[model samples]
Target: MSDVVKPAVPPPATPARALLPLVLPALVIGLGSSLLLAAVSEAAELFKDVLWETLPDAIGIGRWSVGWIMAVLTATGIAVGLVVWKAPGHAGPDPATTGLVDAPLSPRVVPGLLLATGLALAGGVSLGPENPITAANIALAYWLGRRLVPGSSGQVWAALGAAGTVGALFGTPVAAALILTESLAAAPRPQNPAERTPSLWDQLFAPLVAAGAGGVTSKLLGVPSFGLSLPAFDGPRWPDLLAALLVAPVAAVLGLAAVYAFPYVHRAFRMLPHPVLALTLGGVVLGLLGALGGHLTLFKGLDEIGELAADPKGHSAGALVMMTVVKLAAVLVACGSGFRGGRIFPSVFAGAAFGLAVHALVPAVEPSVAVTCGVLGLLLAVTRQGWLSLFTAAVIAPGIGLLPLLCLALLPAWLLVTGRPQMQLDESGAALR
Candidate 1:
């Protein structure tokens, strides 16, 4: 008989003793990273605003029509291409695929991603800079953790970095925790022991530190925390709750349709001769939508929130419906044609428009409250982030105590939509082909 060898026993963890050593360092690194990210975001936003104010007139001297937009797109494309070519680590993958999870960037690549995203957003691309900001934050955090605590494993640093980054971006520790848990659930596992698993406790610790730092920095910098302080609605009425409940299934179906349609749209666009050609076609489609909606549907929809809120009833119901459809088409085309951006803002726009339409039909409910509930319900249904959806809706129309009604609307929609397969390809972009 052959001799049998016994399996080697692994060393045991030090239980509570080991936790203390990690706690302080993790907080230091997380908080530091969060503060740095806030500074970076403020600077980027200011610069973009300045560019938008000055660049259009300067570029418009020679040509009257489409000159500024064309110039912006070309410049943005070149900047993005350079970043992708030279600093692949900086170019965050499509946010739809990765959701809100953070991944570390090499220090060298952070600048490139930041610049690329800033230019793209400032240039009128239908995208937001948050994804790139989050990417850079995590990367910097990882680099700092590695430098300060040489003994820690790369995986530990990565988890810390992700938690910190999410906290900074969302401005809420609980939301960050939820994002981490969802991301960890979604991440695929490797067959080997060397591969790491992200733990729930690990997700909580760093995000908590980062959120504290972010809140402090946001207050100091005069940046909004994206939190809502809505006015109290007369105690939640059953009729309003029932109406919101009725809307849930509609939103859920729309979200499911979007996910299912995304891949096919993307594949169709990829058949173009080149990325530039694909994007130009996308621009044409967007321009047509803009013609129909009077330029409101063209960009990332950040500035339009105020317009949407202020003039919910000023425009005819037909205009709101037209804007909704055009904006949705523009988003689909933009994402399908290889434009790099996040869908969060666009989803907000779409949801808001949809809510406005719904309000037109049902006259009893307050328009603001109806829009708020609709936006939250649809965003949660599509993105599967109930907390983020709640916060976003509340912030958009603060002073309308609609959270309970919003939650009532959202929870069912989320249940209907969750566990459906995601539409975007994996980070490597392999699955899309």
Candidate 2:
């Protein structure tokens, strides 16, 4: 399944003249999208500091105190609820119903989505900024591109925008490329013989340009690398493969459990009278879990997971398990209740913690091997994208030596998750395809 086979008939070469028009537009979309992502992220960080730091100091309460954590989360839920209830476009559909790249939303929906996203991120809602940011950028790009370049297609701008946002989010173009490849491969080929089907590279060329620009802009802004700091593995061994097989499947199972529960959770939340009530109650549950699991289990899990990777041994097996379970539940609640964020970041964090816990218990599995396999499985189950799952795992635990092992280990997890319900939902609130 991983191998690439060439088509029987080659595609007609794309003219440089035809590509020139896209070059300028792709560059603009990439740069503008990155700036939008960065600005919103910084704004959220500012609010986060005030909510978790300055306010706590002013009130003379522990930042991690149960009451304080609950208060802030509940308040955030109310604020976001108001936005969803009153803001234009209702924040652009239930977040649980959306994927990383969907149809571009109305531009009117962007502000509310960004506001809700900012609140969710600031309040340690255990979600990341990917989905909403992508949606906002796509909307903005499509809206402006149609005006600025009258001949450009909406699909063109949407693709460029999605690619750019993905590149910025991951701090690399390869992730965008891999993700877009999966999407492009799913597209139906033209049936007419006279109308040549484009090769994968041709399909990806414009998006890649946009992704590169976004990635370079993000790097220039000094975002930290996505790779985690794990103890290096010496080499792949039979035992390590066995360890990966053991760890990856278990992590994938945990992720699938959440995927299975997603709709049920969303249904439960919808039973409430209002979005405000549902989200506020959801926030309370998250706060209780946070207090139980500690702050390590809060937020989107990127920085927290990095802290764990930096010193995997510092946490006990029990603590790691608590963190993983709490994070899984938090993601379900945060997203199910209509919080604007993505699951990938939280899932990555959960998988890493689970991997470290396995190491703590077994003591034989190498940290690098365990971490990568764990992440690979969880991402596979959560995102249901093969190349994406593999790429993310490799990025989190950077070691060329582990690539072959990861690829092989992915087979079992992929088999387990294939045909299962995805994390997203359809219009009727059932599991989306």
Give the number of the best model, judged by lDDT: 2
Candidate 1 regions off by >4 Å?
Answer: 1-51, 57-96, 102-108, 184-203, 224-232, 394-401, 427-433
Clashing pairs in 1: 105-139, 230-399, 231-399, 231-400
RMSD of each: 6.4, 3.1
Candidate 2 residue-wise lDDT, 269-362, digit = tens: 9989898898888888888988988998888887898899999799999989888888999999999998889988998899999999999988
What value does the lDDT take at residue 365 in candidate 2? Answer: 90
Q: Global lDDT of each model?
A: 0.62, 0.89
Rate residue 299 of model 1 by lDDT: 63
Alpha-carbon runs more than 4 Å astray in model 2: 1-7
lDDT of 1 by residue, 1-433 (tens): 9989989644333456656666776676557656665665566567665555565557554221344445545555555555544555535554445545445657787776676566556555666555566666667767877888786676666666666555555565655666666666766776877755445574355456655565455556564344322234575677778777766557556656766677777778667765556656655655455556655665677667557766666666777778776776766766766566667777777777777777777767666666677677667655667667777776666565666777677777777767774545665443321
How many clashes (backbone N, Cα, C below 3 Å) per candidate?
Answer: 4, 0
Give lDDT: candidate 2, residue 375: 90
Error of 2 at 26 (Å): 0.8
Q: Which 10 consecutive residues of model 2 have the lowest summed lDDT?
A: 221-230
Q: Report the lDDT of model 2 for residue 101.
A: 90
